[model samples]
Target chain A: MNTPNTSPSPEVTRTYRRLIPNTWWLKQRSTILFMIREWSSVFVALYAICLLGQLWALSEGPERYNALLAKSLSGGSLLLHLVMGAFVLYHMVTWFKISGRIFGSGPLSPGAVTAVNYVVWIAASIGVFYWIF
Target chain B: MCLIKFIKSLEPLWWSLFGLGGAIAAFLFPAHILIQGVLIPAGILPKDMLQYENFAGLLSSPIVRIYFLALIVFPLYHAAHRIRMTLEDLRIGWLNAILPLLCYGGATTISIAAVVVILRLS
Candidate 1:
């Protein structure tokens, strides 16, 4: 059975989308940094995995652990670490700076928040150094 | 009773881990990276500083074990969440149904592995 078509059509058809260009995120400086920050977590995860690998090596014995550490000290590993370090550091600083916005906006100043964040971080670093040394 | 609804309900949980992980990454990851990456390679720090025995001795403390747990686990979730979102942003929306499970599931598995390694170290 066929029924008569009942759908109404506008005289002029309109599509609603405002197409986002592939480069939309790259158009802004802040967004460029934002994408970098977002992408840096992969390196952080890689670092974590490296640490886990070291833990497994340590479990196997000092010989295996030392071998792993030596590999970590190799030129290739050092360069990889340096690249990852730069990315992760960028991630951390940007993350700290934007934390105020994450919690809420228009209450506490971001400057004050950033200052506090750095201060505590410095203190923690000092404590770690004291413990390690 | 679809997977999307299931994932939506867990949003808060993953987001909380994301926040915590971000903070911990700020705290420890950079310093370790600098030490292991630049300073040691540049010879500013002694190689013996990270020797297996010395590092093991450092990890022997229970408190340090907990810190290690935080360092390893939190960042897994953070990376998972970020990567999943980035994939979505890249127009892989059709995969959305399985993305959450794949991302968060991978993180959970790694987190468990990290916990097991930490316990062994302790």
Candidate 2:
């Protein structure tokens, strides 16, 4: 075996790593949308908290729960939840779209997987609404 | 052996939660949101849908409690995982060591609190 060189070697290439801007995601449309999709988790978690708040109010007895209901029925709360709902929808849509690929390409095609997801989503929605009404 | 060990790691556990939560949220949140946030508030559906006794009765069911808990908690872990990844991508890695603890720990706390509140609903 050749002995390892102990002295400093001339003009050895250092490991090359290019620095990326933190804002690089902002620069590309696809990247921006990707970031939004990921960041949408913030809204999902926030909305889950909102739902938990509803549950908490329920456990607190009727008066508090009705008061919370009254607040929710307001136009401002309506508008806010509408915006929140949009984020959740975006998150779901992007998720379902990509779920096709993550699910693997066995018997079902990717488009078929996506279609099945949407079908199930709509059926679940209808089933819940029916149960509620 | 290495692959199995990796699969058994906390990463996969967290990732599985993320995927499961994403699937549940995608399938469920839309209809719930539409009815609760839009249709009801828009006066299309009556506010009685959320009236205390009715909702309380709904929550009193053990299965319903568990369903709602899964709905709320899984997505929390899902969100936690995504938030951690997103923050790292945004070059916020200085807190690398604490990031998982913060994210997963917060989810765990909320989950416990959710379980407590939900179990007491009856």
lDDT of 1 by residue, B1-122 (tens): 37657876899999999988888888778777787777887788888878887888988889888887888899989999998888777666468668888888899899998888888887
Clashes per candidate (backbone, < 3 Å): 0, 0
Candidate 1 runs further than 4 Å off: A1-23, A102-107, B1-4
DockQ each candidate and list the results.
0.69, 0.76
lDDT of each: 0.82, 0.84
Cα-lDDT of candidate 1: 0.82
TM-score of 1: 0.87
True contacts kept of 1: 0.68
TM match of model 2 to true structure: 0.90
Model 1 alpha-carbon miss at residue A92, Å: 1.5
lDDT of 1 by residue, A1-133 (tens): 4456754456435667676765678888988877888899899889888878877787778999988888888899989998988888888788877875555447668777887788888887676666753
Model 2 alpha-carbon drift over 4 Å, by segment? A1-4, A7-16, A104-107, B1-9
Winning candidate number (lDDT): 2
Which candidate should be chosen as best, given TM-score against the real structure?
A: 2
